[model samples]
Target chain A: MKRTVPLVITFIVGLVLIAAMFIPHWPFTGLDSKFSIFYDVIAVFAFILGGGNLLKVHLSRIQNRRRDWKYSIVTVSGFFLMLGAGLLKIGVPGGWTGDYQADGSLLKYLYDATFQPLQATMFSLLAFFVASASYRAFRAKTKEATILLLAAFVILLRPTPLGYYLTFWLPKPLQFLHIPNLSTWIMSVPNMAGQRAIMIGIALGIVSASLRLILGIERSYLGTEGKD
Target chain B: MAEEEKLTIIERLGAVDRRYVFLLIAIAVIIPLVLHYATSIPTSEIVQSLFDKIESLPGGSRILISFDYGPSTVPENQPMANAVTRHALEKSHRIYLMALWPTGSRQSQQLIDEIIKVEFPDKVYGVDWIHLGYKAGNQGLINTLLSDFKGMYTTDMSGKPIDSFPMMKDIRTLRDFDLIIGLGSGFPGTKEWIQFAGDPGDIPVGGGTTAVMAPLLYPYYPKQMVGFMGGLQGAAEYEYALVKKYPKYAKRSRIASTTMGPQVTAHLVIVAFIILGNITYLLERRRKRKYR
Candidate 1:
């Protein structure tokens, strides 16, 4: 009964949403918008559940003294710090009438001074890792590897002065062979074609997978379908 | 001499600690950046198309600028957002800013603070621009906003009702906007904008995206998307175009140009390492063949 009830709900909702897209008459005219609002409202509420789970998991870890429990303390402390800052409107100028994210708020300070830099620094670490990984990957071991190596070499130089400086003197008629021009072509043509194929494949996969879910053939999302 | 008694350059290259590579990259990137090095970028056709579109837009035309990225991609997306916003402001277009990602709203606010308020202090808030903050439905938000903007955004970023903003008076749906500039990085980003809002509303869309995600978006350009800026290189090209035409900005802040120094330096370092690795591999292969 538990499984059937959710399955029926899914099928009905999925079919109706699909139908609404095509019909667009009477109640269905603004049905997508209504459903979207419903989703937004639900998501906002779901945050409590999500936050609760997070607290439960982290608190349990700290209580049990799990491996790396010290990190959990930091996590819990940071979460509560930001949450308290935001919820209490602590240090917000002009009292509660103003925006929580407004200037002079502790939340704003934490976000701008701490969160933004941390995120940017985290993302910037990719440069080092990518440089290290690519050095190892771009070796000429096989025919395909040789092609990739050559392509990587050209592309690496393409966006910078090295590519332009190396090939800027090329004849106008042979401009297509220029490193920058070649790089553009490679990205726009072959890369685009490959991307389109992948997108289309992904779309089809989604449709198929969605159908499996709607028909209740793909109940794995409900947790126990795989075992069954 | 026995192979066991001596080490080849290839073996040595292979044995070099990854930290050394990381350090080399750091030096290559940082020194050039600190020195404010730059190589001028010739605007490519794709970027030129975008520049032309913005240039040709009639004054007072509304441009919906969506920042569907987060702080993680700030290195790539921020410069493009700054340049694109500046170009729109220069054209005297009304900017309707919004965000799909949660972090996008914050990024949008940062842009407005950094560029709009500082550079174009004369521009009015409600009339010249309005920030719609962010919506939570991701692609679902786009689907609704395409047909009905008010259905999604009832209030501006500042919590004022949408009707209160003079600039938002005429905008009823995403279709009302003359163009969409989706500055994004990953899923629920440029791709989602193109699929949901741009395609459905037939709005001309251009994107500023991270380098890694750029190639995936190319297939949509010229047809669905007008043009796109990918990574620091794309941002640099747009900045060059902007300054070349409006030389006043030439003396102004140069985010992408300053960063391009490190970008170019890092690329060279990586390429040199790649070449050395290849040379070592080939030499070792030859040795193994000769032994066999």
Candidate 2:
């Protein structure tokens, strides 16, 4: 009964939402939006629990002096500092009435000064990683691999002035076969077709998985046996 | 000498430390950035289509610019955002900025504070541009905005009422806008816009996404999206077009083009390394064959 009740509720709600998309009747017309608001409301309350859990876990790690607990100290401090600054409206030039995102506020200051730059710094590491990964992995062992290598070479050259120069001397009839032009064709035609194919497969998979869930066949998600 | 000869090119390459390769790439990036190199990147049609879309739009046509990315993507997406906003503002299009990602709102505000306020001070707020900030429901926000934008954005980014903004007066729905462009790095971004609003409302849409996200969005081009700018390269190309057409702004900020020098150099370094790695691989294979 413990699992059965929840499954029933899930089936009913899920079916209703699915039906709502196409029906557009009295209850169904705005049900998707109404449920979205319901989700937002629930999410707001869930955030408090989420925030509390974050604080608890990080604080415990710091207290116990676990491995890399020092990083937790930074995380806990940043969390509370931003929260307090935002909630108390601390150091906001517009005082209590203004937007929490107002300039001269501690929250905004920290976000701009620390968060923005730090995020950019983390992302910039991708350049090094991509270079290292490509050096080690981009080998041409097979016909397919050779094609891939050639494509990569063309794509790499396409964005640079070097690409323009490489094939610039070609005759007018062969102008469209230039590296830059080939790059465009590769992205728009083959790339688009591949993406679309993947998207279609994903859509079909979702439908199948969703149906399984609806029928209670996807019981793995429920954390216990469906028969139980 | 025979022992040295026995060492295959692959063995020699294997002995070469990875740090040297990293140092070479580092030099490649730094040199191009420090020294200005004249690089004429011919505008691709995809980029030109986006340029033409803005160019043809009648002045005062509402153009909604959605800042759908956060700080992690700022380097890639921000320059494109700058170029797009600059072009739209240059064309005298009324701007309405919004965001799907929570941090996207802040990123959008950065553009306004940095570019809009400083460069185009003559452009009045409310009348010229308004920021709807962010709404939480991702696709649901688009769903609501399709029918009634007022349902979601009752106020501007600040604590000001939307009614006060002259630009907000007529924007009852997404359909009312002349064009909607999304600049994002991931899900709930251009894909969401393409599916939810653009397809349903038949509104012209465009995207400026990170290169990683660009390939995924191509199916929508010319049909769902009029055009798109892909990553820093796209940003650079658009910047080139903008500057070339309006030579007056050639001296103004050009971040993408500046970054492209490093971009091109880095690509070359990677390509060279790949070739070197392959040579080692082939030599090793050949040596194994001879032994067999």
Candidate 3:
């Protein structure tokens, strides 16, 4: 009964929101906003579930003396310390009344000194990964591969002053053979076409996924079997 | 070689060493960037459309500029934001700034400080422009603002009331603004702006986004979205247009074209790697067939 009630509510709300998109009138105009507020309220409650899971996982790891138990200890300690600092407003000038990130506050200090740098470092990893991925994926072995390779070459040359120099000797009518022109053609036409195709696929995928959820065919997010 | 006794070139081509490709691509990207190569590629129709939107807006039209991206996409998105801001300010358009991302608020503040506050001190905050600061409700804040602008955001970044500002008097919803510019990177970004604000409100919206996200937005162009700038190349084109139209901004900012040098080189490197991979696959196939 507990699960059934919530599922019923979900089905009704989900349909209403979808229908609201087409309806331009009053109450319907505000329906989307109200639904968003409702989702926010539920998400706030779900944070408790997340916190409980975090505690359970780390505590069990520490108690079991699991591999990398010290890491668990650090995680648990840091979690509590941050929580306490935020809840109690530790080292915040003028106590809890002032902004948590007010200049000279401990929260701000920790964020700037520790969190900001950590975030930046994680983001920087993308550059290395892009290089690695590009190296492996960009290979040519067939007619299609050769075409892709050549297109890539033209695109690459088009972006540099060197491209202009290389194609400078070409006649006025043959200027279209320049690397820059070739690159622009590849991106605007071929790239745009590929992007549109992928977008359509993604859109269809999203529609299928959303429909599955609305019809109660996808229950995995509820921590249960896929089938309801 | 007999068909049953030997592998074909196509099969061999499929089995190339990936490392060789990677190495080749690295060379392709590095050489151009190191050499400081520059090219003057003619602008595309899409980029020109975006330029026209800014150009057509009457001088001093009120525009809302939302910086909805963070440092992660600063490389791709910042140039567009700067160029658009410069274009608007140059046209004498009044700007109302806001951000959905927490970090974006600070980013917006930085732009105001660096560009408007410093360069154009005569541009007053309340009358000429205002920063509504960051709101945490994501699209919900946008949804609310559709009906009640003051309900969600009562004050500006400096604690000034919306009512106190003369510019915001008739601004009951997003429709009041002449144009809505969203510089976005990911979720709760340009897409969300289109869904929540532009489509329903019927407001004309245009903006720039990271290359990765640009593909997803192409379907909405010239329809829900007036125009869009994609990646570093798009930014360079916009920068090119701005400098040619108003040379004053040419000195103030050159973030887009400067970054294009690296971007172009990187693209070339990727192409080279692909070619090397193909050649290696073909050669290995030939060698294997001979032995068999």
Candidate 4:
């Protein structure tokens, strides 16, 4: 009965939200927004679940003296410190009445000195990873590989003054063969087509997933996997 | 010598070192970036289409600009956001900035301060446009706003009620906005805007996304999305269109187009490496077959 009740609620809410999209009546149109507020209320409670899970996992790790348990210490410490800073508004001169980062707030100091640099450093790692991934994946062995290789070449060549220098002598009519022009075509036509196809697939996937959840076909997220 | 001679092109292709490809891509990206600041690449059609959408909107039209990205995508997304905001301001469109992501509120604040406040000093806060601030619950927030915007968002980021603002008084739902411009890097971005807001409400929407995500949105162009700007290239294109219309903005900002030089060069380098790797693979395959 417990499982069935929630399933019924899901089915009813999901269909209503879907119907709200097409129907423009008083209650129907407002249903999406009302559901949104309802979700927010649920999410607020869910945060407690997440927090409890985090505390449990880390506490267990520390108690067991697990390998790399020290990292958990750092994680827990940072989490609590930030939590306190946010909750108490430490060093915020206006006693929580003013902006959280008024003048000497800990948040401002942490954000500027520690968080900003850490975030930037993490983002910078993408450059190296992109290089590494491209090196490993961009081998040309087949027809598709060859095409990708050539397209990549044009795209790279077209963006620089050097590309112009390299292909400068081509006749005006053959200027379409210019690297920049060719690269534009590749991105707009082939790249756009591929992206659109993937997007459509993803859209359909989301719909299927949402429907499954709504219909109670997927209940793993509800924490009673076999009951459904 | 006979065995070596018998090795085919396909066989030799297999033995290419990956490091060389990495080095080439690095060079490709770096060189173009260095050159981009010195010169500019021509804009593309997709970007022009995005520009036209904003341009065509009547003056004083309400535009809902949702910043649905974070710091990770700021480099790619920030430029597009800035360009779109600038275009709207130039057209005298009232900008209603909101965010689905938490950090997105800060991003929107930066835009308000950096672009609107700094550049268009005459633009008022509540009357012209306002920041609706970040609300959690991702698409759920969007879903609620679709029906009763005032119900969920009673006030602007500041504490004033939506009813207090003259512009917002008439605005009841998502359908009221003339255009919805979503700057998205991932989930709950352009896709969410299209599904929850655009598809259902029959509101015209557009988006700016990272290049990797751009292709996925093409099918929705001129339909769900009025137009889209993809990565740095799209930003550059939009910048180009903006510059053509309002030349002064060209001097002020060229974030997207400026970055295109590196993007193009990097793509080319990857292509070359692929070819080199293929050649080596073919040669290596041929050599192995002869030996067997």
Candidate 5:
């Protein structure tokens, strides 16, 4: 009964939503959106579950004196600090009625001082890593590698002023040889063709997988396998 | 004999320390940034289509802009948001702001502070523009809004009922908007908007995204999407178009174009390193053949 009941519910709901897409009338017209709202309401509760789970795991680590438990202290403390600031609307004007992210609020200050800069710093590291990796990996050792390398040269250089100067000497007749023009053609044609084919393939895969789930053949999501 | 002694200069360069490459890249970025170097930006057809769509719209046409990215993408996405917001307001279009990510609310607030509040102080809130704020549920949220926009969002970002906002009177669902632009970094972003809101509602969808995500969006151009801006370069091109149409903006600080000098310099440095690496590879192969 445990698995059967849930599967039955899923089949009913899935079929209704699928029918909603095609029917678009009366009770079935907005059923998908109604279901979406139900999902959102449930998701809001799931956030509470997720937050509690995070605290539990980290607190357990600290209690057990586990490896790198010290880092958990930072996570746990930061989480609480943000939660308190946001919930209480600390430093926000008009007390509890004010916006949580009002200019003078503690949550606003923390986001600006800690969150924003930390996020930017993490993303900025990608530039250095990309440079180091490209230097080491962009060698033309094979025909495929050479083709990739040449394409990379054009795309990478296309946006730069140096690329413009490099091919500016070409006559108007051969202007298609210009780096920017050539890169655009590559992106709009070859790259787009590849992307479209991949997207179509993914769409078909999703349709099949969704159908399987709707038909009760895909039970892995229910945390059981094989016979279940 | 020392093993290093037998290697040619080119071979040695192929084996050059990555630290040097990092240092050179750092210098390349820092120097241009310090100098405030600027360059002429060329607009692409894809980016121009978005700009044109916004420009062609009549006054009071509602344009919804969703901030579907977080702080990490501020450098790439922020300028796109600002440029579009500025352009839309300049044309007297009504603006509707919303977010898919939690951090997006803060990002939108930044745009409000930096662009709308400061530049277009005469633009009245609730009448000219409104922020619906961040909501959870990702693509599900979009789907919910498609059928019942008001059902999903009862209040503005500041907690006032959206019904009180004059600008929102005509905006019953996704189809009401003249345009929808998603400034996003990843999933539940531009792609989700294209699928759930744009295609289903038959609304024009466009966006700006990080460079790494740009390739994925190209296939949608001129069809599923009106057009889009990709990365910092894309933002710079849009900014150039903005300035070209309205010369008054030329005097203001353009973030993307200013940042391009460093970005371009770094690209050149990486290109030089790649060339050096390839030269070293070819040289080593020749040496091996000669020894054989």
Candidate 6:
């Protein structure tokens, strides 16, 4: 009964939503929006579950003195500090009714001082890694690799002034050979074609998957080991 | 040590430690930034189309700009958001701000405080512009918005009822907006808007995205999307276009254009490394054949 009930529910909801897409009537017209709101409300509760799970796992790791457990201290402390600062409205200008992230609030300060800078620092580190990786990976071993290498050079230089200066001496008739022009052609033609093809395939996959789920054939998502 | 000494220069170059490469890149990026170096970046047609759309819009044309990015992408996405907002306001467009990601709400507030309130002091809140804040649903939020805006957003970010705002009076659904600009770095962003709202409602969508995610969006341009700014480069191009059109903004701090100097230097450094690596590879290959 437990398994059947969920399967029956999924089938009904899925079919109803699908019907709602085309019907556009009283019952079906706004059904999607209603379901969306329900999903969002449920998601809020799910966030609480997620937060509890995060604390449980991290606290257990610290308590058990697991490997590299010190990192858990940072994680747990950051979580609690931000939570307390926000919920308690610490240092808020308008007091209890004040915006949690209003100026002069502890939450806003934490976000600006610690959160923003840390996020920027982490993202900026990608440049160094990209530099190192390109040197080692961008090799011209085969004909395709050589073609790829040339394309990479053109794209890498396209946004810079050097891309303009490099082909400046070329005749007016051959201006299409310019790095910027060539880069645009490459992206618009071959790159876009490939992307479109992949998107079509993905759409097809989504349709098939939806059918499976709607028909209750996709029971693996129910954590039933995909069994009947 | 003795065996290492016997290796040729090409072999040594090929095997150079990655740490040295990282140091060179850092030096390349820092030199331009510290020197306040600047340059002219030619605006591309894709970026120009977005600028033109805003330019061509009549005064009080409702434009919905969604901030779907977060703090990590502030450097890339923020400039695009700021530039688009400034352009929209300059044309007297009624702006509606919302967010898909949770952090996006803060990002929107930052834009409002730093750019809107500071620069366009005459622009009234809840009339000229309003922030609907971030909603929990991803694509589902968009799906709902396609049919109803008030269904998802009952109040503005500050808790004032959305119906109380003059701008919210005419905005019944996503279709009410003349244009939709989605600034996002990843999923549930520009793509979701295109799929769930723009395409279905036939609304013109345009926005900026990170360079890495730009290619995925090209197929939708000029059709599903009006036009889009790809990345830091796209942002720079848009900034340049803005300066060319409005000379008053020429002296203002154009973050994207200024950052281009460092971007150019870093790209050159990467290009140089590629050349060096390839040259060493060819030399080593020739030597191997000769010895064989």
Q: Against the true structure, whose DockQ is highest?
A: 5
Q: Rank by lDDT, highest first.
A: 5, 6, 1, 2, 4, 3
Q: Going through the candidates in order, what is the number of backbone clashes in each?
A: 0, 0, 6, 33, 0, 0
lDDT of 4 at B90: 79
- Is 5 or 6 the stronger prediction by lDDT? 5
TM-score of chain A of 4: 0.88
User: By lDDT, who's the top model here?
Assistant: 5
Report the C-alpha lDDT of model 6 over B121-148, residue by residue, as the tens digit: 9999989999888988788788888888
Root-mean-square deviation of Cα positions for candidate 2 versus the true structure, in angstroms: 2.4
How high is the DockQ of candidate 6?
A: 0.72
- Model 6 chain A — which ten-residue stretch has the worst lDDT? A219-228
lDDT of 3 by residue, B180-291 (tens): 8888888788888888889988988887888777767776777888888887777888888888888877666677776676676666565545554556566666778889
TM-score (C-alpha) between model 2 and the true structure: 0.93
Go through the candidates in order and give each one's C-alpha lDDT. 0.85, 0.84, 0.74, 0.77, 0.90, 0.88
lDDT of 5 by residue, A110-142 (tens): 999999899889998888889988888878888
Name the DockQ score for candidate 1.
0.69
Give the clashing pairs for model 2: none
* Candidate 4 global TM-score: 0.86
Per residue, candidate 6 scores C-alpha lDDT tens digits across A8-118 of: 988877887888878878787667668877776676777789889999999999999999899999999999999999889999987887676889999999999998889
Question: Could you give the fnat of all candidates in order?
Answer: 0.65, 0.57, 0.31, 0.50, 0.79, 0.66
List interface RMSDs for the candidates, in order: 1.4, 1.9, 4.1, 3.2, 1.2, 1.3
Q: What is candidate 5's lDDT per residue for B270-292, written digit by digit as tens?
A: 99888877777777888789889
**Candidate 1: where is the Cα deviation over 4 Å?**
A225-228, B1-6
Q: Model 1: per-residue lDDT, tens digit, B163-249? A: 998887888888898998888888788888898878767789888899888888888988998988888889999999999999899
- Cα error, candidate 3, residue B234 (Å): 2.2
**For residues A1-228, could you state the per-residue lDDT of candidate 4 as single tens digits?**
668888899898999878876776768756766777889668667777887789899989999999999999987887788778867989987675745644478876776676656776797667656765555566666888778767766765665666778877889998887777777778768877887787779879989999999988998766855473
Residue pairs with clashing backbones, model 5 = none
